[model samples]
Target chain A: MSTTLERPALRTSRKVPPSKDSRTLLKSQIRTGWALLAPALLHSGIFIVIPVVAVLVLSLTNYSFGDTWAWVGFGNYADLFGDVDFLASLWHTVLYAIVVIPISMAISLAVALGLNQKIRGLSFFRTAFYIPTVTATVAVATIWLWIYNPGSGLANGFLSLFGFAPNRWLADPATALPSLMVVGIWQGLGTKVIIYLAALQGVSRDLLESSEIDGANRWQKFANVTWPAIGPVQFFVLITSIVGTFQVFDLVYVMTQGGPGSETRVLVMDIYQNAFQDLKLGYASAETVIMMIVIALFIGVGRLLQKADAND
Target chain B: MRRGVGLTLLAAALSVLVSSCGNGVIEKSTDGVPPAEATGTLRVLLPSFPPSTKGKEAFQKVVDDFHKTYPKMKVEPDFATYKNLNEKMSTSIAAGIPYDVMVTGVGWVQPFASKNIFEDLGKYGVTPDVIKEKSTPALIPAVTYDKKLYAYPLIADARAVALRKSAFREAGLDPSKPPKSLAELKVAAEKLTKRDKNGNITRSGFDLASATGFRQSFTTFLASTGTPLYVGGEPNFDNKAGLDTLLWIKSMINNVQPYGQTNAAQQPLVLTGEAAMGIVNGGVDCSADGIGQKNCDDLEFFRFDSGKEIEYVGGDLASIGSRSRHKDAAWGFIQTLTKPTTLDAIAKLNKKIPAYKDASNSPQAKSNPLSQFVADGLVYAVNENEVPSNWLEMRGNFDIQLTQAVLGQKDPAKVLHNLAGQSR
Candidate 1:
């Protein structure tokens, strides 16, 4: 009976009229919440929202960074389907994302797992893996260009050690995209590894021990405990990687310029060529719109998978 | 109320964007010119000189000379690269602050002029005849659009083929009698090509120097066939000469020289001894600091003569912006840019030949044999000029489609047809 008397109220009175001071305090809290959010809201509105709206509106017109513009409502979009360059770029970008995302994720996870173990020179190895992520894309591409040099590149030199024929890595259309994919995977590994490393470190050790006591093997321990524990992080990595691989430009621009007969041409490269090179700003904006929609769809699919995993 | 405010803000933003896009058309300049005593800043965009310390110093010297004429006028330079010049120009124009003076390349005049981005230099007494008398007559058609001079010639960037005397002698071919026709060139290249035990190209017979694309080489070869890539903005390469030129380039790839091959440094293979012969740029450095005088002595330059003995020539040209209020000062600045000493300094810094009629006598040309050869060949220069307003766009298409043909990924005829359709 004393405990019942001492218990705090679990709910506010439904029909009570608040005191002036209480109402003012609530209003002040609301104001503080808004004040905390204002900067980020303002930044998003100016940078992201405004540009997206501008691009959407511009996509309906034939504006070429010139004085005169005429609205041809969806004509640019209609022409985009028929444009061979646009279609090719879209296919290349999608193919790049499909090939790069899973391989990069798996490789990064394996590396993260290796680095997570007790080892000598662990910090050194970790830094070595993470360095590429921090390096500038242009600088990385330049170094890779040297590495892919046909006659004297490190790649050819390595091939010669095994008595294999030298390959024109970036200059050959058959190998250009694959060579770029290797760079893309290697460059993107560092960040994903770091993320996965953090997630692997956070996997509950007690749960792993319990699984082991239950006669679980290493594979079972990982499948049941570690993998599920890193589910949210895996979702995050997948979505971000999908978005990143879709927007790859600087590497391709510096390395091949989407060359060897447009073999490495990606969506962003095509959009850039249209906007800045061809001076077709409106058509490029339409390309941008389609790219955004595709990225959104990818993210949506990722969300559905996350939900399914949670249900399981 | 929050939703209402959000909608209102978006509406305001859209209105602002729409209104901003409406006003970017540059207005024609009024006849009245600003006085020489003008005090405002003159914004100049130049891709002519690089943005290096040496480039800036050379450009600053010209600016100082301009200040001598108009001491009160301030000059702000945007030293952009040719790759980024179009981007900078488009953004500046959209922002309603177009540069007062713009220095661009050969094929850029028509595209910019069609949009009225450039002022008609004829109003300031820069006619075709004036250009012919003062500069290389070959560049007149390059700077002219609709029978009016839109730009003044700055520097001529020429391409000529060079061969090694030692390599020719080893092949038992006369070095002095360079191949004049494509057929002779093919036969000579086949003999000069060297192979390793693995059937790899140890030394290329003829380096196209086309790691990027065959467009420039195609242009040079096409001009030798007595046809330009485009004329009056129409596709002129859809004929027999075009097909033959594409076939010739394809047949040579991976036979004499590898497709899309370049030295590690991306320098011309002829200079690096990776090839017996190759197309070289306007100038070669023969100083001890460069490829060395010994290597230079082994080289001899020649022009292609299929139907015409034509060398590919491109150049940088300066123009006044139509929207510039400081047209007279801009014109004055352009005059200082074209002075003999200034032209020589810029040509030396850029490793290009001055577009002046007497450029062969310039110290930069006299010191470099390749520059001298290019300067003398300016008379027989054929440039990708007098093209349609969409030449810039067409050039990119040509680069990619031509690459496809050279790589054997596409049929030459189909590619030509596709390119012609794009031009239309």
Candidate 2:
């Protein structure tokens, strides 16, 4: 490495740069980049990669939070298929992801479109919508819980003026998931809207002007010009949304604790319950690994969709 | 049910086998020598609060007091919360962290004791006679299995209703009395309930019975109503009181009286005075002096005065672990805390009833509501250890089932029957 650096110094010049020396210099720079990156790589490997691998290994064991964990290969996985609870949780999580990811994307896109118009309060609107993303989960959850309260919650209280009976948004099994989904969408929209807004603003006005001149209506211009440019941004949001929905734990934990007779119970909730409440660490690890795989599949599919759309 | 039977028999057989290895009687210490005052460090572990903090400061203070008398042994205290305390303790013990004393709740005594976590005090020369008069040996049954005493039972925590005296008066009921039976309480609840024109309850007369959601409070009523949760070493929540209790709670929500809104999302209005009365944890919280006193100062206690002699009394019990390295220190702590004088001090200070029979009459201890409640319900206290692995998982299942029942999504009886079958 030192010899390569010396060679770059000795042979390389600015106007007639030595290709060999430049290549050596690049190699030396790359070596230094890796050296600097080692700590981060080591951290991710130890904290993230190693634990993820352990979860896969633990997925085959019999472990609760308190009980002495023991290896029982494929026991947890086998149990997962046979367990009605896990199946329900899996279904709930998938449905939640299916509903939330798309709705959040649409709302985000709408806000992004509005922001792309160069509104007078663009910065204020941007900050206002993005505020929820920065708010604490617990604080946001608490406020939303009040807003969703059946009798006196702000939502029901407002609805009551028109003679609507109080709806137990968080308590009713049917409403609970949707209520949480709304909150999730609300939280995601803040960040998603900003991303799409930036991407939309980056679109060339010349393209839209040309489309308009070619007799394209506002809707046609949007469909033909604006949307195509922001496809990559939409894909970015899509991948994140899909991955996030599968691992929804904190909201469920705080809002319902997977209650109304496990109606709101999701895969992540089951994993946490097994690990902490039931002290079944190994079993939880198995559930976690299953979630990990689901996330990976979602991201994989998301990437494919992005590629296909981009090609189109 | 099969697991329950198998575990019980295995435990019984193990205890018998272990006894056969010894002289059949577990003594305090293995050696024949008497318990002479020896000097060493004795470590005591508990949460920063009860069910360990009860005797902690007192224990340390007394240890200091005792050291002035003996000038020898040292007593050290360890504190953690109930949430992760047990895990920390279990991990520490499993990894040989050398925890000498564990000041834990009494419920854990049997499971860990049967597992031979603590040295049997009886094996070390602690005789039945010493425990009989000194401690509530009645608790030994919960702490012991197959004639081996594992944990030293120290205190009994009881649960009782803390009705607001002012609310009772305003509702045209006697402040001095509570409902004599579950049926009567339902009536009282009706009178206490205040509603808006929109049919929304403004002030709930009583807690939505499912508020506890199948906890010790809910189970206390189950037991009070005579639910046969156990029979002949078999599970027995298949009948009357169990179904009755569940349905009665459902009725309280769906028909007779629905008070405070069930959605906690509705900002629990009681502390804010929206609800009139609630069935609350009768631990120190209900005590006139415990933490809840700040908000519920006007709250007064009444044992569920079951018109019959059968009322339900449930509270936590403190016990020494069988695996404790500081068994002697623990015994000393238990003995001191249970003594009428000290028990009275704690009971009065915390505003709870003392488990010791004598503390009921102690001037300071009896001045509050809990002691009087316990005095009313002494005959009704129940201590059945049916499938007692802390009842935590079962509690979860029951909470969910009960929630469904309260929401009127399922018939209480049917839900309970399913829970009974599933729990077994």
Candidate 3:
């Protein structure tokens, strides 16, 4: 008879809803959370969402930044297909991203691996590598411009000491884009190295030791133990690098202005010319939309890789 | 939680989209008034030719003088480099916050005017008769759109090949008589070029790779030949004359310094005595960054021609903003800035030619031998075809093709043909 009475009490308490005061407290907590997020939400809405939507709407019409907008549907997008400059610019941007991202990643990773060793003055070396990443883009470009100078420049002067001929680094059509790529890679390596160094700390030393005890070589040990550890960070670095490469403007503007036969003309530069120089805001908006799609695709691939790495 | 976050984001995006579309509708300005009757603060935007250069001080003095002249009217000056002026002006104009009077380039006049960013000076007492009387006849076309005056021609510039007499004499050529023909220029360049033991050029004969060398040389070359590259507002770069000109330029590049060899290659080479002849600004004082003022006594100026005796006049213009409420005050400021006295004063200090005929031929300008050629070129100056709103676009296209050709990465004919097709 006592057991039956205890079971009913337990069931009644278990099935009971929250008190009015508790419910009100939960509602207040949610309101506070929302209130905290309100500022960021407003900031993103005003700056990012509004501009994005406006660009999308403008891309569909022949909007010239005024009340005069004719709904041209996808005419601007259609025209982009046949626009040689647009095609060339897109190709160059992709080419740049491809050349820069891997090179930067490999160099940064190598440096990170070397610096991960508890060597003398490691912190100083790490700081040295990261200095370029913190330096202003204009300041970096200006310095590189002098370095790339054909005559009396440090690059050619160094080459001359080794019996190499002076090169018109940023001026020749054959070498301008490549020279710019070098600067891009150099400037980008710093941040990636720092991130990889931080990520390297998360790399399990016990796993590596066990692999070494299993008679694995350095490459094999790294492949099995370390690569997986830093897989997520590598993916993050790659996505950021690709995004940065796609949006490179100031460097090109300061260095070449897309010169030496449109060799270094990237999508952003093309968009800039159209939007401001050509005053074709609608056309530029369409280009921006395409850039957004391309970047999204890249980010999506990166996310997939991250997920696969997580699953593994 | 995810649903709530998504809903909040959606609501935020919707509100933003609504606000963006609601704003940015430009209200048409109906506040333009005759300059004589205007009274208010005049926001003047002018190009500040670097502080290190005399151009900055000269322009500042012009502004100061204007302020003194119009004591009752306030003058707000915003200075920018020419490189950033186009985009800056466009953004300001689109935002309806343009200066009362702004500096404009020759190529920018039509594009800006057509976009309704410039006030029709013709409506503000700057009629055709007044423009012709005040500015050069050749320049009137540059600042005119649809036969209406849109801007005041402020400064005039022309390009000429300045031959180093010393280099010519050293090359066993007559220093006194410069090359009058393309063939002659090539012969002189071949003799004047000095190569090191490794076949690298130590000194160039004729440096065609100056700052903005290709475009400047190409324009001056075409103008000298009297060939209008722009026919009916379209770039006809595939024509026989265009192809011939390209080939000629290619030959010149091959004989002279290879493209992009030195920094600011032409002027630097010429000034440093490394180059025999090269294109330069028609200014006597245009000695490369240093070396004081270049003397006309040591240099001779000649048009790059196959004997057509033509020259292209290029320069900046001043215009009143269409959206400015102080149109009269802005116009007054523009008129003051463009006055013969002010033009002459600034021109003398900056070593640039004044657009005003009287100011250009004043005793001060006459004393400068280099200004003589610039003034003479104004007689045959050909305004760039302004009918196409894509003037800057076309120039950019041409620059790319020209670069490719100069670098010898692409055949001139092929580049020109491709450029023509792309431009079309």
Candidate 4:
């Protein structure tokens, strides 16, 4: 009885003061953790954090990659708001995101569901779907450019087979943005499909079986079990999709160059033109800040939706 | 500990920002030429030479020739393309390592000269009279900014209208007498245009090429009307001539040609037989491998004659950087570049006419009929230079806004007005 009471006291003493070895081990673990993280942390600090800060500082000035620059304190921001070209680019980017995100997400999810089932040539289908993601955007865009050629392209040829008139897919102002959106969707599908495939595979098989036992139909099984289980992944995909569509540059740059009267001029392309072409670095930085904020707001809304979904 | 790390990172970032804010103004050096024995590297930024093995070998010969003059000076070449030339130059300027010499294009002098990036070649005895005596006199205006010669011409890129003799004959027009005026050309084009049963253009009568081509076509037509797009950094086309030119272009779109169509190879539509007639560039190949001699013989080139007969001329120009320590060496290098043998090789490589008085006699010009025609036309060439310093920025805006006007999305008058406003 006395020994047992001593054991309790000893345990209390041990809790009060961790041994020197334990303390050293804890400290060493933290040191190891920080050591492993240092390269990435340093990279982020230098490339991301520093550039963002520099851009913020530049947005307040009239820096045009020249020697002399004067501080204008939000003047660039004011100018950006009034700039018609920039406003159009913003609207184009927003419209692109709105059209691209939901459709791409739905199509990819459907593809992911179909591929998730035990099927023949599963690996081949998976690789085929992921090939576009790995292909260089420039190469893809060039191929698409050929495919959109009015006279000899596959797109028009396919349309001709359907007894439809040949459309100037990228050349017409009416069709240019939509044509780009199609390329954007097709190019983005692979990554989203891969992500959804992974998330779908992670959905609890036991939960799905239980839903089926409860007389749940196919749609009901997906709605109750798979969808809820993949809610976090859905949020992740939404945020990524929003960011990706918002920052689209190379595709449009190669394809149309924001031609046909700036019909396909997206935000990043406008920023690039302002910064590099017009030599208006400060104004471009302000545009970049606005773009970042817009993307953040979209992600925030996505987060809210995910939280509400979780509550439900 | 984390707070300390955060503070350290913040301080580091702020320091970087502060350092970047340092005044990047480079002091112009008017010092006399470096001695022939100077050993430092003489860096050159040029888009004139193709970055290919053959191009490099040809450029190396030029460098070897320069080495004969300055045997000790090492040469560094940055063969950037025209599309990325501005980016490379701006980055170099920001980095405080501006090239010793830069090769740019026509209409680039004013913008770069305004920024004091180029050294006034006047100090080195490059006067308008000297250029007229030694080079194509018309390019003198292109190299002059604020009455100072900022660049020396390297080659001439002239555009002339070409028509297929067969197409002309088929349309019941005289094959020898190509359309000389804009009005005549429009009529000829309408007649030559071929359409399918569904009313889609099977063959464009006049290929404006695409939206990008429209911008150049506008310059070609506007200059023929005795007015340039811009004069001394201001809009010269905001009046009647500009409106008429734009209206003419708008009228042609989807009438004589499709809105934005080009052949599969992106070659001149006339050359590819995609269009009956179009504005052709300085050079064409009539070899067995190219358009072939028989087909080439069936084409005729002509200049636009409205208020004046003129061809749109643009060219690569060599200039010394203001901050160059070896201005003398740079000038010597440019002189060698302008030599007949070197210029001929560069012209051949670039498919341009040598910007010299005797350009028509250059080997490349003598071999290609189209090139020879362009070289002969260089005498009456009018370029898109002598414009405002903001012309480079205006070029892009012109392409987009002009497209809007041509597509009938915006009124032609308002488009010109807005472009004029933007140029300011």
Give the TM-scores of the predictions, in the order they appear: 0.93, 0.75, 0.89, 0.92
Q: Can you tell me the DockQ of model 2?
A: 0.10
Worst 10 residues of 4 chain A by lDDT: A4-13
Q: Per-residue lDDT tens digits of candidate 4, residues B274-354?
A: 899988888888999889999899889988998899988999999999878778888988998999889899989988998
Q: How do the candidates score on chain B by TM-score? A: 0.92, 0.70, 0.83, 0.91
Among all windows of ten consecutive residues in candidate 1 chain B, which has the lowest summed lDDT? B1-10
Least accurate 10 contiguous residues by lDDT in model 2 chain B: B1-10
Best by lDDT: 1
Per-residue lDDT over A1-312 for candidate 3, one digit per residue giving the tens place of the 0 to 100 score: 354444344645466789999999999999999999999999997767766787787678765533356889999999999987899899898999989998999999999999999899988998999998889888999899899888778999999999898888777777889999999999988889989989998888889888989999989988788888898798889888878888888788888888777888888888887776676777877888898899898888878878887787
Indicate whether candidate 2 or candidate 4 has the larger TM-score: 4
- Candidates 1 and 3: which is better by TM-score? 1
CA RMSD of each candidate after superposition: 4.6, 9.4, 5.7, 5.0
Clashing residue pairs, candidate 4?
B233-B387, B233-B388
lDDT of 4 by residue, A70-151 (tens): 9999899998888878998999999999999999999999999999999999999999988988998889999999899888
What is the alpha-carbon lDDT for the whole of candidate 4?
A: 0.84
DockQ of all predictions against the true structure, Cα-based: 0.32, 0.10, 0.36, 0.28
Structural similarity of chain A in candidate 4, as TM-score: 0.92
Model 2 agreement with the true structure over B1-424: per-residue lDDT tens digits: 2122212222322332233345432223312222345555555665423445555665565566445533555666666555554545544443333355564553455444543455566654555555565544444455554466655544445555666677789889996777747788788878888877876666777764344354444565666665535442244665777677766666677343442255443323344355566554323343443335655566666655443334344333344554444566556554554566555555544445555544355554345455555544544555444444433345566677777766777777787676666553
User: What is candidate 2's CAPRI-style docking category based on DockQ?
Assistant: incorrect
List ranges where model 3 is wrong by over 4 Å: A1-16, A65-67, A205-217, A310-312, B1-40, B48-72, B209-213, B261-268, B286-296, B363-367, B383-387, B409-411, B417-424
